[model samples]
Structure formats: structure tokens, C-alpha cells
Target: MMNNAKHYNLSLDKRLADELKSIGFIRAEQDLSMWCGKERSYFSSMRCRGYGLHIGSLTLMAARIADRMNTTADVRERARLRMALNIVNAVVQEKCRLREQELLTA
Candidate 1:
């Protein structure tokens, strides 16, 4: 029973990965026809299709680096380090909550 369940789960995970690969990111097909204009293509003023994604990635990268610097190095003031740690903890807690909800729904 355990072996069969494990195999089924592995196959399910593989199928999901394949599906995601084929579909690509959800924002890859972002439409600007709603508030901007009636167009399926990206805005001419925008740099790329993943600017929003890139912004999120950059924010996370900076937070992780700053947290590490604050903890490992003794450069930041006590108040600043405390605020950074609080932000990190909040993000982690939110992620955990989201995962729990996902698992429950699944």
C-alpha cells in the first residue's frame, strides 16, 4: 500500500511539473486590454513581460541578503535588525499559512 501510494504521488508530481512546463508562467499571457487599451500584446512603455515577477524576485533577494547581513555581521543597529527579523518572520508565517491551506484543499 505504501509503495503504491508513493509511486502514485511521484507520477502525480511529474505530471504537474510537465503541465507547468508546457503552460509556462501565468503572467506570460498578461493582457493590457482591461484598463490600458484594447491590446493583447505588452505595453510599449514596459521593459519586459516579467517586470512584475522580476520586481518580486528582486525584493525577496534583497530581503534575504539584508537579513543575512544583519544576523551574520554586526553592522546594522539593533532596531534595524529587529525590524528586518520581524519582516522575515512575517513572510515565513504567511508562507506557512498558505502551504497549510493548499494542503488542506488538495
Candidate 2:
């Protein structure tokens, strides 16, 4: 069970990184922090702690990806961005549902 969870986390990280790279966040932590409006090393710290991006950061990323999609002129690139946005949106929704469930149980 622990291994499965770890694998899932790693896959999620890779997927998010790939999407971010696709949309021009290629300068590692610097660009990612800037794009997500976070302090330098924020994301790096989160990853080091085995805690993936918070919901707020994910929300910000989704919004930026949507904005990029709108301004993108190439249909293929727009479609790609749209797909990335969809993935981020789904993750956000899942996180929200989990939070709601936690609150209900509490």
C-alpha cells in the first residue's frame, strides 16, 4: 500500500511537471515559482517533504494554463494546453472532494 501511494505521488509529480514544461515553465524551480506566484524554493520544499503542490497552487496553475490556451494561436498547441488544463481541473476537483470528506468525517 505504501509503495502504491508513493508511485502514485511520483506519477502525479511527473505529469504536472510535463504539463508545466509544455507551457514554457522550463527553467525549473525559478519559473515554476514565478508562474505559481510562490516564493522561490516553495515548490522544492514541498516536494522534499513528500507533499505535492497544495490545492491553491494547483488552482493558480490551472487558471494560468487556461489563460495560455486562450491566447495560443496554434490549434494544436491550444488543444494540448486544453488537455493539460483538464487534467489540472480534475485534480483540483478530486482534492476538493477529499477535503470535503475529511471535514464531514471530522
Highest lDDT, which number? 2
| Cα lDDT, all candidates | 0.37, 0.71
- Mark the regions of model 2 whose C-alpha exceeds 4 Å error after superposition: 1-15, 18-34
Per-residue CA lDDT of candidate 1, range 7-80, in tens? 44334323322332344311222321111222444332232422211223324533654555567645445444
What is candidate 2's TM-score against the reference? Answer: 0.67
Cα error, residue 89 of model 2, in Å, equals 0.5
lDDT of 2 by residue, 18-58 (tens): 76677654447556666567887877787787776778887
Top model number, TM-score:
2
Query: Listing every candidate in turn, what is its Cα RMSD in Å to the true structure after a full C-alpha superposition?
Result: 15.9, 3.8
Clashes of each: 0, 0
Cα-based lDDT at residue 69, candidate 1: 59
Model 1 gets an lDDT of: 0.37
